[model samples]
Target: MMEYSDFKFKKMQSQLQEYFDDYFSKEDFLFTLDCDIEDVWNLYLDSFPDEIKGIYHEKPWHDCQRCHLWFKTMANVVMIDDDYKIRTLFDFKTIPEYQDVFRALDEFLKTKRVENLFLHDKHSVGVFRSFAEYDGGFDENHHFYLDLPEKFYEDTENLASELGDALTQRQLFEDTLNLISPDAVDTVLELVHSNSLYRSIQWKDTLEGLKDVFEEFSQLDSNCDLNNWLWKKSANLPRNITHIKNTSMGTLLLDITGGMDLEQAVTNYEKITAPTNYQRPKAIYTAEMLEDAKSKIAELGYMDSLERRFAKLEDISINNVLFANRDVRTTLGEGIFDKLRKNVSRKVYNFDEVSEISLDEFITNVLPHAQEISLHMYPSLKNNFVSLIAPLNEDAPSMFQWDNPYSWTYENNITDSLMKERVKEMGGDVDVDLRFSIQWNDGEWDRNDLDAHSTEPDGNEIFFSRMKSKRTGGWLDVDIIHPEKGKTSVENIQYKHKENMIEGEYLFRVHQYTYRGGDNGFKAEIEFDDTIFSFDYPYKLSNKEYVDVAKVELKDGNFTLTSICDNKVHYLDHAVHWNVALGDFVPVSLICYSPNFWNDNEFGNKHIFFMLKDCINDTNPSGWFNEYLNNELRPHRKVMEAMSSMMRVEDTENQLSGVGFSLGKLGMNKITVKVKTNNIQRIWNVII
Candidate 1:
């Protein structure tokens, strides 16, 4: 990572501040810059290397698997994106320890600066050869992709600066075309830029992209020179092997040495050394090069014509697309590739660099595994690990499990005072004894300094500094610290004043203040109490309930929202309350204006779980689904507690920003978000 001077950071930050002060403060202006999910992923990756270098190691692999992990982690940078099912990067706010990195958020925001960046023109999946000329042996097919973010251009100066970077790279490539030597560079550039093959959206990392292509092209004509002796002209021990069959010539011609004797054909053999000082000629592009070139070019798509474009070339067809599909496995009392298993122990490192770890540990730690972790890396050999298992198998290491992002264990035994009051109203004795406690378990090495805070009814705040407010009687009895390295620690926040806790409402919170040492293995929870609303601090919900919807709580790792209406509890899980990325919303009886947290990427992006207040289609009680919703969907504090106990999902971050395009203010109420869920939209008649 190049050292980014603090001056540069502050300079960029100042420019952003200037733009915000000049434009965002306006009363009549609407945001002109907007990006979608795909664009968001690209923009983050483009600028991420510079920003994250101080934190993460450079990408270690050149394969497609590595490519996919790159995208997943990039999505993690912008809290909105994910790898469809899971969060590869836990987008925790930068802890206090890395305040400088946290403050340098301008780099992250710069991703949204899309003045001259190209949009993703091609969204093809799978790997294939690159058409661009390259001699580097590392020129492999693409199984993963990286695209630039779609930007809304409102600033010309910012746009010009960015456009300059990409254009300069192309100029350098063209200038090299004029170089005196390096015919392979010219050969590749000529083929790739010709009308027969061209790609408008090649790669955004121009400098890196050009360098990779050049390296691959450079390998086009490399010769094998062993032990300082040239192995030239050998029909049996062939050097300068050409993959193409142009001119009907064999890959190379072996030296006859003016004799047809077997002993003379072994000129470069261990016993003979007639030309030990000779330098082998470097390989130039030939018909044999065309085949691998086509293979590499085929990855860019349009594979059928590379044969037609060249003469005397034959193309062989492979039935399957996935590398794993080509893998061979045997089950005749033995497994395929079993012979190789003896040498394959649990490896912790690859390429003899960096710490080595297992696949499970890598994903659990949210680290990058896109490059080396492949089901089958051998393009032809493939993966046969799954073929050995039977259909009736009870377990398979290859099985995929969809795990939740958030988790925690709480004391379910606690009796809520509010519940006790309702029980007494039903003519029952109330000698309740339960204190509220929320605990968090982080990763082993995680230095998660999460603080517990409670705002008492008497305007008292209890936290690390004021552990206990004298007047408010609020206390943070256990301010747990993160365990030492190699140790796992659980932190707890307890609130138990017995009857004295009844004076007023209490807002309890647990937040990660200085998040160091780990990724997503974070869990948080809460013990049910009268104070039902809790959020990581600096994140608060609007108490003003929109319609009947109120702020929900994360209890025992479940995502649920509940509201009390006519002393009945109307509650729903993440599915009923949360919408999917596919632009869908399941409206329950009532909803609130609580938008998903766009926390500190904190652009004022408006989001609503339900329809706008006036937008609700009030024509109720029509379908059988509505009947169940009205009758069985009872709204009460107790019912909410009951539902909370029954089921749970991981408490995950829900940053909604790109969703704005689908529901831009113009058709926010009119646009019908397609609901994708098993349950029907729940509607109730009771008023909150």
Candidate 2:
């Protein structure tokens, strides 16, 4: 056996390169010869250890039968059973680490060879078979030899010198073998020469049948770059390559090209190109631009000053008296009286003399009138100026009260209290007054009485009168005397209708009385009798109480005296008149002033006559009279004609008042009637 020395290592490397060059082209190959013990250890442990193990241990013994079976199974399945005409080696049981190394080298070499084959013979399908099977074991198998070029030998020797002699001969031997690509020699030749090589080749073709039944022993090492060739055409190669080198290869390409293995190269690149902290830049401004802005600002300030001055001058001309007399301040401030004085002074003397008239005197007389006119012309101006000048500390009396022109001073306490009391009374509450007139005349007496009073008189006659005039007719010229004063008397007077047997009484007196003697007093006589007069029924004054039938007689002798006493002889009812047809018996009832028709007999008779005429002459007779008359009289020709004409009905129908009626047959009967006679006449009509 050749001792594993440096010279032997050199020879082995040369042969390995030569074999690789024969099968693979130069551009498609990656050759690495790391002589350092650490580099060689890492390459065996990291990059391609399985290939190294296959080469040494799997070829030496079959002590581990399972490993050998696994290798055989993979080889048979991938080749014979699958009918894949590919070259495969199952030497992993002999040297598993060396098998991984050989696998990696074979893959790299196959890629290169495929490219060369494609370029040379366009019809070539490339290597077609290219995997290495590893079982287990690293130390013995990783040092297997392969053919290499002479330049590889020279490079290996130089690397070993650089690494020094501290490395073991076995390590150097393994590293030298790994440096040589696996595709460098004819796989067929190696298999034929080895003891179990033919069996290995045959097992590779037949492994497919055992694949489903076999337990896979060698797991795919995820740490290896199985798809490194697939990424060659990618645009993101740099980032992807860096990632693969750091995580999978454990070394960078830069360090590897500098004679380091893949793992050490990546570690060194990371150390050299680590990121640094960032710094921020400072801000800067130009002084020239700042100066230019300031200059523009100064120009704007000058323009603003000129504008303010022009505005001040305009204000003086438009608003100051020195510039224009008709300006607001001058005309309003100097007022009408001042203007009048100024005109007088101007016509009489010069401007200097007119200026001598004090502003106080001018404002006192003239400003009041001018303010009145200004209130009518420019009302808002007076308010605006008052509001504007009111806050000023300067004492300008003109501005103090200029806003209100109608303001007047209350001088005396009497008038002030009166006015304030009037306002307070008006504001206190609401009140209403109702007034009515009552007129009557006797034989030698005629009287008209108008009574006016309110519930809330408040002892203020003027106020009551004013309110009363507003409610009733116009202003009353007659003197009014209260019931408390002796000027007017109040008497409880009653009125009764004898025919209706209804009566009512009121507190009656003259509201205003003038001196007229000889029975010129208002008297009301009341009496009650049976057979109530329908038209003369008494209505209640305020409550339901019948008045006494005693006559109330008031005599205006030296003064108006009213008497109210119950004397039956003095009592007389007012006459209630009603009209009836010739043969119709009306069941006569009279509300009259005299029961015996002796005292005041003319007045009673005249009242009855007038009321009868009114009833008979009334064109539109009411329905109440129609029912009474129709029931009392058996319908006669004259009565029917008179009723029809009065009711204004069609001539073909007989109507009483406005209601139609007809007489079917008259019943023959004799009726007797008693009658009363007056001094004028007494008559009776009998119907048979």
Candidate 3:
């Protein structure tokens, strides 16, 4: 009941700062249940104890037997949060048929053979199911009644807290000892924790541990000032600490920061300072002297209660490791990882086994808590090792692990380019390959639910929701539905070659709908036939700034980029579309797919006329546009074939021969063609 919202929580954490390095509240509580009387009968055959498992087989035919929750004890442990509340009682649900089952079991157990326990002899009482059925059979789950108390864990915590308060007061009472001589307390803790010789052990047992300090302090002159010898752990202490010193290289008193037996510490000091006026010592300090001094210190008001507090915390552990020592905390070694994995898989019957799912799925389920399981990291580093605390709540799985890191996943290993090439090599055609890779700092990308929406020219949007745009030959070939769940990966959206693909303006854009945090980024590459266009948007890829990647126009047969991101018109060397008027009559749209790759390397001695239809309304289509048009601005035969297809004309087997071609408009955006067709002069306008 004492939760974080409690008023005294902050004081608790601050008061016990050394005891706890870190602590946090669990989001929810776990369950341990026992369903029925069968569980009780079985537990009776075993030891008559609340704990210690029973050797009885489960009743198979019972309705609740399949659940196997007969008698599982929820770890009945007490926890102290940073707020300093000792939380013992947790909210629990009652089992069904409780009163009837209790009555039946009580009546049945009176005649049954059972071990002799204190008052409750024959019949068992309260089988709090989880802490429920056991040998004792319902003998109150906890010795301490866990009702919602006005100050629930308060009284228990006070035992320790009161001890600390008393100890602090005890230090105040020993003011006479410290005032008389500042070095009145033995500085044993200084030697144990830090080399600085000033204060004694943080515990009340400080004086008891001073026997070893003599040798370490031997180097310092006995006559040195105790002020110089005594050390201060924290500069921000409430009061200035001072040590007593004697002049003329005589005996010195080390500064005492806590309650110390003044008379004994002075005696010990005198022994060390005395030269004996001989070759040895004045008076050898014995273990008896140290013990005598410690006894005097313990006798101080409330210091006795401080001892009980230390006793209470003697067996304290955290993160499954004993933390009783001030110097060290612990982590399980790699040897136990497999053991832990097995225990979670075996012992916890309620949860599905962790090994059943892929490590990615496992990590996916437990993130951002499972962040230590880095997908890209090598397992050799200690920090890289994944630590999974069992999910104690009934509904959640118990464990998760990266069985093998350093290896890539099937989806992760498949890059768009590599997959495309492999598919093509196996006779799978990739008419249009679109791919993009994105990354953010730390693991913020994992929180980002990224989605790309590509709207074709005809207003057909291709997104994760609606994957395929068949009419536009567009397919969300491979998109990352849950980008965070997979490898830091790439997003590829594709479109196969279709007749209407080059109809009008084909605009495809990448939209990042959600950005979790950190620096946003993106890199996309598009491959249309032979040309590959790459775009990099660093730190600018976010929900606010969606990238309008590319716009391809097929007016008069041109699949070219008019503009890219931000709608910035990235003008090309030549206009993308031109008028391919058939016999100077009807205007038709055909693909002029002359990407940069065409002029760069692929076009080797191929003529532009090779692409035109072999028969353009009885005119030699290949030979007609050959000589009169500007071949310098044209692509190879394949491109012209795609272009001529716009007119929907038959392209026969015709060799490249556009003989006697004439360019009419000098520097204009039109190409006038005058070619001898069928022994007649023909003039045509070709828009460039």
Candidate 4:
């Protein structure tokens, strides 16, 4: 192998530079020099022909071609530091093989006694010659110069001394190989046998050394198995023991007595003492013992019976002995023997066919009639059917209508005299019955007298009257009697008496006047019993009573008679009265039919009002009466029907009294109206 010291390596670099400068300029020289050096170094090192190439490769020096080439290549180089300095001038073109010429120079310098030297290249000399022949003059300043300093000799000598030591070491290594031992050879083999510490040792050396040791061992014992020893130490091995023994049998071991062949010995031992087969073992179960088992099972006669009867016996034993309880069976013919037989057989029923029976059949036939069925069947079916149909029947009867009229019986009565006292205690009016009536006859209070009298009447009137007993007539005899003829007429009369006096009356109008779109104004007429009293003067009455008789002719001389206040029109048509001191006012009542009725009037207009218990002074009677008549009269075409539909007054102390309209049922007419209070105030019904 080629060897290099630090000094020889530097000298080689210097010589390579000078050789390049001998034929090229400084710019081209450095560029090509790196490529040439790499090429030569690779050829010297990579092509070295020897099994042992270094201190690591133990082959002799004579067999190493690389060392010879290296020395031959260096023989021509002259060892002068300035001549070999790569940057100095040298005439390389003058010498045919410039590298060979330098090698020769190198060889001569090592032996010769030369001291100071200067190097010049052919290119530098040519440049000087060309300049010397110029017309003006030869300026030597432009030509390349070589100067050898005195210290170059000392440096070259130091470099030579170091190179000499490296050569001496190579020589010492070549002479020591014969002194190694045979047992030491085994130790070396062991060191390389998969030992990580010896990984740096070359594989070629390890294998050759191991082969030599095995050969020596083989000769000592002629019957020894070299192949087995090598196989055991090999990097690769057969996967199974049978294959291992077969491949290395005679070569790995010697049979001295020949009691049995290697294969038979292994087989005999395996058959008698192998892992006990809890059951019979199979021939091809595991790949490692497949070949041995193939012949062994047959030679023992276990194979013939295994195919014919053992497989069937194993399947039946697994089904009966191991898995017998897994299969469910139905019992028939009660007894121990029958149960055992039934348990051996598995049976199942079709549930779809079973569920199709009727309830009676399920209870009578499928349940009680079947011998082997669950006892829970009846109650389970009963619970399911009850869960399905109970709610339907339980909710059915409430769907029918039942009567629930407002009852005046004691159980239903909700009146309170204490509530009336509470209103009075608050300084409020508490009178619950301030009654008034509109009559259409004139007898006692004549219309002509009041219309022509000096007492100018208010536009409305309020009066209080009390009845006096008559001793001449029986209580039942006080019936409807004629007043002054043609004063008033009555129809559909309902009468009732209490304490020798008739207390109530219900009558329809005998005659009514219709005005076509009358202008807004106040007009009123009053009839008491039979008297006709017409009033245009606005007046108010508080406490007064006078009786007179009058007559009115209508419907072709059918005379109507009425009694009234003497020359006093105590009541009037289209008039309103609120008894503030007595807390008596007409109690209006309301009924709604739908949720939307409160949004508009029952007639579908938005006009509405409240009837209160105390009439305020500034109330416009004409306007108030007109609105009441329009809402209560015009819509339903019947005055009684409109009066019945009125919402009842709910009394509050601050609310103004007397009749006025209120917004009625909203989106529908069917709704609930809460009266809420007994002391009268504003009144209206709410729908929805």
Candidate 5:
């Protein structure tokens, strides 16, 4: 009956150290320790110095039963299984925190270590070598693998006292064991000695079997130096010793001594210490880099001095100018990255820098570049200057509207009012609550009949088959068969009285009845409950093909027109065009005209005026003139110039400075235009 405190672990430690020293002194015999999982770690550490550091200290041991140890030194490799299921001592429970320790240990053991202590041994060292019925120990021909049966509480009944102690001690020794340099020596030794099942491995195999297992070890060349391996060989010890050198290069020296190879640590040090060749690009004011130019402009009331004006202009940014011009923004906004030119840097000139240059130098160098508004950047720069002083000068043109450039291009501009006028001039009835009209001609006019159909609010329809709705008094008044060949034809549906109309949606459509002419283009005008809209079908419609024109809502005397087809033009490429031959209506042949010319026009100045030869010089006109192109038809010098250029006529007063191109035979006597109004050719013929 010995008390645990009187067991003298310190005296046993001294005896272990002395035994290791004496054992290593035998030069001919290579020794190996075969112990249980508990005592093996303590025995291994007893042979090494107390300050010795290794990956063994870096990681800790986890569950022995669940995770078996796979160890690899430079010359030896072994996989050891805990014959006793260690977890059963703690009630067969898992400690999750120690799982990380096992994972790390398992990973490190798998890798090849070139500087391990086993590399110094002449032959393989048998660790945890068993000599019982359970076969273990070093076999050069085979790798060690031991599969033992799991022991439950019934099997572990003999060690019930130690098992109970383990359950209570688990929390106290939580995550404390290291697989290589284990610290829990007392607890492990206590458990191992208390269990008699593994006592045969401790005494019989560890003591007697060593002689039988290593019988040829004395005959082999056991020429390892114990003193040199332990103390003399500097590389044998782990690099945990931190010593500072008395030089400027101490940090680099430390890294070299700490096992960091030259490529990894020294290369980076050279890069940091060496001279750099990199030079950053000079900062310039791009359009994005400018400060808020709009706020600066808004703050200025007026500038009386040229210096003040120049200073304000200098402050103005390219962004404000670029935004002001619709053409530049659109051109650059779409695919700006793809369209941007490389190395397009421009030097910014301050007020003083600009003032330094003479008028002659500026005119020769800057003015020519500045006036090139066609370039993307010039317009931005020019606009900024104009915008800076535009508020002060009443006579100056609007900020971005320099040279009267069009904001947008051409579009279909034929409206309901224009169609209504054309209808009246063609002797067709337009005064009604609802009207659906269709007119078409091919110039080589054959007997082609297009029919206009309207479904009244009461569900009664009016067309060629049923010219009159009996229920609603809606009539297809002018159903032209185009019986004669030389004239443009018309078809009209009208509800002449309000009493005949019902308070609901009215649907209007046009059907191409007979395909007799080469051109099947047609125009449709819908007017219902005081609302009106017009559509032009420039494409040839197949026989019996229907065009759903519009839906008209009539409620409480209010009228709303909703187009059925996607008729509102976005781009000119998709817009429908109708060609009308004005044979003897005008003296001039026509070319394409700008629809957006009026956008750049100044207030109180008549910017657009084009005479249609015999056409009246007024807002409302007769004959098929280019109404869509010249939106406001009045009398002006700029308009006359634009008209002469488009018509290819000689403007003797203005010198015809504007540019023009032919619109399919601009020199011909018969001038044709894509008309959107109903029977435009007929109106032209009647007017002349």
Candidate 6:
């Protein structure tokens, strides 16, 4: 049996030698696997023909020949493990089970045809050259094998180091493509090929791709003297880029900047040009301007109804509307102020949405519609609008002029006259150089009792319980424990005479003594050294909670105010707190719609109609009026449609405050209402 196997092995070896001699001719022996020579002999022997014990004249060589041919072509280039499966020389022991190398080979076979592939072994040089010269050895089967050679991996690392060294220029030009212009392209190509980094097999494909991008760019714009432009600009490009991950513009910048981050490089490219210069003109609204606007209204025959709307303006004058000339044109044709209100409500007060309207547009869309404009603007533009308008207006109203100081929240010039006027209105002492006062407003102010407290430089606490501090001679005057239901109430702590004021830090704070109503926040003001500062607590203070409003440092007869409240300093330090309307503060204006005629003579058989008046046209005065409905009233969408239908015609008499069809055979009706634009929840009830 041993002798028979030896004979067969010798025959197999002879056959393989004959095939190699014919294929390679006089070339040196090459293309051997990493396995031992005995393994090759054994592999060939396994495929050798089976001999009949003594009947072996000459067995057919078909199967043996086929196995030998496969070995000479692919098996010589691919390594075989103990199980006889083809694999590359790279060890896969550290990888997870999912990355089985044989499994990868099977997947690669599906898409690619493997010609004479050498896995970059010691014999790869000769094998690679031979295959390049002769291409007719591959079979029709299209089998595949993946060879991850250690030499190629090493080359990748070395190439990265060489590329970094080769790409010496880090500075970038504005126009990256110019660096590789038609005139400079040949020089650039010579530089790339001569650099050992790009000539490597690893960067060969990348170099070709870059050349193609340049060629394509040149073809697109033939008239550009890119060569001359590059010469003048003087730029350097990377020796090789294996991958470009950004925009084409950014990629070229990366090439010029020698591997700067794609996003940062692109941002720099976009900002290469100087920005356009534009200075917005200031918007000024003076008292005379207000009068002129009013005169314009009178000329438009809207003086009577306009005055009625003026009564609802509260702290905002008609000049406020005319000066919001930076009109906002939205998809809904809404005005800018409401958008400002919404933005301020969200603590974002940017005017990017505001756009200027042509004079013709103002005349056509704004001027003639005084009643609609006035009615639409009525109360919502009360406080926060000042924050938006003050910066634009030359004669902007003082922060003191605004009812909601929290809305125009910023440091501003609080003139002495304005302070005196506010002091007189609150009935506080104006003779004193230093005064601290707290005021709060709500529809149910009588129920919410808040007290103001002050700690003087002498450390004496002055509050409602201890109304006077003799050490500092400060009086906690005008304490409103039970405030008037409809009016804003003030509690004052002041040195009655200027001489009584001391030079030291004084702390001002507000204590929520009783909260019988909804969350009602307070506003506090301090005047010292002829300068006044305002602070607002636009947050709910639970019954016993205290807010350290601010601290005043009075040294060398100069006063500096520092707010201790958590609220960040707003854009307009004096603007009313943007979130005030979301709290318990009363709406700037409220209009109640009562049935003009109700057949209440028979209780069960009652029918009532609520009328909507001053309807200049159908669909509720479009523009600002529509904004009021969506933001302020936020009535049921169905109610809006019904009101639009009812108020279709211009009514000279019997103005409509509300609109609803007759209620038949019902004793009562309930309509949902929201008092402020910030509250659109339909949480309030109106009964008729």
TM-score: which candidate is best?
3
Candidate ordering by lDDT (highest first)? 6, 5, 3, 1, 4, 2
lDDT, candidate 5, at 544: 78
TM-score of each: 0.17, 0.13, 0.26, 0.13, 0.24, 0.24
lDDT for each candidate structure: 0.28, 0.24, 0.31, 0.25, 0.34, 0.39
Candidate number with greatest lDDT: 6
Candidate 4 wrong stretches, greater than 4 Å: 1-75, 78-161, 181-186, 189-688
Please give, for residues 1-688, the per-residue lDDT of candidate 3 as tens digits: 1122122323322332222112212311111112344555453233222221321233211122322232222112223222322332221212331223333444433323211111111122222222344466642122111112122223444545643543343343233233433232333332223211211122224233222233334455665433212211111122222111221111223423334343354345435532221111011222344355445434432122111100011121222221111111122233333343445422212222222333233222321111011111111111111110111122321011211111101111112233343233222234543332222232344445555566776688877788777676665644544453323544446665545464676666666667665355655555553444555555545554566767656555445656674544232221110112223321111111111112222321211111121212222112112111124212222222222222222222221111111123222233332322123333333332
Off by over 4 Å in 2: 1-437, 440-506, 523-576, 579-688
> 1-688 in candidate 4: lDDT tens per residue?
2232223333443554465444433221111011232344344344433333354244222223433343333222232121222221222433232344344333333332212122222222111111223357542212112222232223444655634533333232222122233333333233334221111133325335434544544464554333322322221221221122222221112221233443343334334433222111111112223345445434543232111100111111111111111111111112432444444433233332212333223323222112221111111111011000001111221100111100000100111222222222222222211111223223332222111010101111111111222421111111112322343321111111223322222111111122222122112332333222343222322122122222222222222323333343333332322232222222321111211122222433332222222323221111111122222122222222222223122222322222222234434321111122122222122332
Q: Encode model 1's per-residue lDDT on 1-688: one tens digit a residue.
A: 1123323433433443343334322212111112343453444344344445444444322212544444442332221111111111222233332344333433444344221222122332123223223355343233332322223222445655644643443333333323312333233333233211111112113323433544544553444221011101111111112211111111011222122232222222212321232221111223334455444434533232111110000110111001111111111122322333344443333232233333234223311111111110111111000000011111211110111111111111222223222222222222212222332332345555656566555667676777766663445544556544543343333443344443445554445566553443333333333223222211222322111212233344332334322212223221211122122322211111211221222123322222111121111111111111112122221222222233222121221111112122433222222111122221111111
The model with the greater TM-score, 3 or 6, is 3
Instruction: Give the worst 10-residue stretch by lDDT in candidate 5.
Output: 379-388
Query: What are the per-residue Cα lDDT tens digits for candidate 2 across 489-573?
Result: 2121111112221112222222333232323333331211211111111221222222222221222211111233323213223
Model 2: ten consecutive residues of lowest lDDT = 380-389
Root-mean-square deviation of every model = 37.8, 54.4, 38.8, 53.1, 33.9, 28.8
Off by over 4 Å in 1: 1-441, 485-488, 519-522, 529-688
| Model 6 C-alpha lDDT per residue in residues 1-688, reported as the tens digit of each score | 4344434434433443444334332222112333343444344344333443233334322223443444343443432222323333222321232124323433333222212213232222211101112156532211112223243222534654633432222123223453434332332233234321111223345545556656655564454444322322221233343122233433433443465443243335334421221111111122333455555445543333211110111233322333211121221233544544444323222222333443334333333222121122212222112111111222322121122211111112111333333434444565576787777774455467888898888888999889987767888756777665555677778775645678788888888898876475877777765445666666667888787877887776666775465453121253222222222222222121111121111222222222122211112221112122222223222233222223322322322222222245232443332222222121233333
lDDT of 1 at 335: 31
lDDT of 4 at 211: 45
**In model 6, which regions exceed 4 Å deviation?**
1-426, 443-446, 563-572, 575-688
Better of 5 and 6 by lDDT: 6
Prediction 3 TM-score vs. true: 0.26
